[model samples]
Target: MTVSVLICDDSNIARKQLKKALPEQWKESALLVNNGEEALEALQMGNFDLLFLDLTMPVMDGFQVLAAIKEQGIQVKTIVVSADLQIEARNKVAADGAIDFIRKPVSASALLDVLNTHGLL
Candidate 1:
């Protein structure tokens, strides 16, 4: 299915890999950014349906992104994709407005499951 996706990760490989894990159309249309600042800038342009966010980065972190999205009242689905699997981290993102969380090196099946659960697939 077609979906507008914004992928924020510091690692170039991780960003591209995450894009590839999405549905074909989503993969084709995904936008990649290196940090939360870039992600926020992209989001402010307001054309994306979903955001795949990483927790740690050089400029701003995923938590900051979530907070800014909330503070700004941006309307978009967000899923935190991070290596940090700490319960606190997950709970924090959820509280900050993430719809879901996916571990790093995400499998296509896992990504697909979130999409299906949220009716994004």
Candidate 2:
């Protein structure tokens, strides 16, 4: 089955880069959103299997999105990708239900590791 994926980030370049980096099959049906609100809306409207979330955003940050997901019991597995490389941030997101936390300027190796660990690749 094709895993439904959502990419939520404030940076257009980051979105484009991630889109480009994704395997063709995965990219074929992926959804991209600019911020957490849109991500939540998409989740409500779509059956996404995975979420790539950025922590910092203008309207509804990723932390809020995570909280909403937990409260609403959204089924998608989330992986936080942000420049916030703080250990506290990682611990908080993990405790909040993120399957994994990835730092920003995501390298192909790191992304591949996440995909592999989650059996998404």
Over 1-121, each residue of candidate 2 has an lDDT whose tens digit, in order, gives 5778899999999887777777678888989999999999999999999999999998999999999999999999999999999999999999999999887788878888898998887
Of the candidates shown, which would achieve the greatest TM-score relative to the real structure? 1
What RMSD, rounded to one decimal, does every model reach? 0.8, 1.0
For residue 88, model 1's alpha carbon misses the true position, in angstroms, by 0.4
Q: Which ten residues in a row have the lowest lDDT in candidate 1?
A: 20-29
**Model 1 per-residue lDDT tens digits across residues 29-115:** 789999999999999986899999999998999999999999999989999999999999999999999999999999999999998
The C-alpha stretches of model 2 lying farther than 4 A from their native spots are none
- Per-candidate TM-score against the hidden true structure: 0.97, 0.95
lDDT at 44 for candidate 1?
97
